[model samples]
Target: MVTVKMLKPYYIKTDNEHVRIVLAYQYFSIIIQEKVYQFIPIEANEIRINRRTQKVENIDAKFAFQHGKDVVYLTMAKLITLPDFLQQLHSIAGTYYIQDENELNGNSSIQHAVLIDELERMNILRLIDKALDERDEKSFYELVKLL
Candidate 1:
């Protein structure tokens, strides 16, 4: 019998269309009989998720293990059968799915606008100071009008 002893994602990558969860050594482990096996990525190492549904779309990953001197490959079919694997994956990737890109863009735009306003105000103050230093009353009054 095989049982999962530990499962932790190495990192998560998100784009507009999908979220990819990467796994690495020491982060994922399993037990078979009395022996513990560590997952080593072979062809693929990521679990692809659909951003809209927040559901696992595919696991394009293969792992191998060293048993004695023989290399044993773990296939997708066997991995999916592990108890609570899907549930645990959902728990880790849940927060990333909840984030809305539009909301983030709105907040970023607001910050940019505030920064631009402050810069413009600073430039006006500098121009006013330059007019006063040159003893140009007309220029000083014109710069002050910007306030």
Candidate 2:
């Protein structure tokens, strides 16, 4: 999954009222909105923003933020190179806070995480089945909308 705030390094992503991020892989992501729209390959980047147009380009900061609690990785923007990602983790491992303890599922954020994980997985399956079966994106999207 992906977060909109995390969208800045790529194209201009609005819809700020709600956002979510998940480490679908070590980097790449799928972003869904209001349980309806979905976008993929949200990468991390070092960027220069065009204030007037609200566009972003020049990705350079892609890396993983890791802790015992969770790990955060970026993909779509391609901000940081793989080497940079590893170096950052090495440097931050000592000074940065890494939550290496058990995950707590008490907070609403955690609950949302759980919900997204389950729903995204189901949605992915649906997307694959539809694509293979020649189902329409509209129907698949609507199914996810309800989900």
lDDT of 2: 0.41
CA error at residue 60 for candidate 1, angstroms: 5.5
**Per-residue lDDT of 25 in model 2:** 29
lDDT of each residue in 1-147, candidate 2, tens digit only: 333322222322223221122233233222333222222324532333332233333344454543344455654254333444334323322232222345433566688999999988887776767865886767667666554
Candidate number achieving the greatest lDDT relative to the actual structure: 1
List TM-scores for all candidates, in order.
Answer: 0.57, 0.21
> Candidate 1, residues 1-147: lDDT per residue as tens digits?
877777799998998888888988888877777788887776667788887787667643567765466566776566777767767877888877855789889999999999999999999999988988999999999888898
The weakest ten consecutive residues by lDDT in model 1 span 59-68
Mark the regions of model 2 whose C-alpha exceeds 4 Å error after superposition: 4-47, 76-147
Clash count for each candidate, listed in order shown: 0, 17
52 Cα displacement, candidate 1 (Å) = 2.5
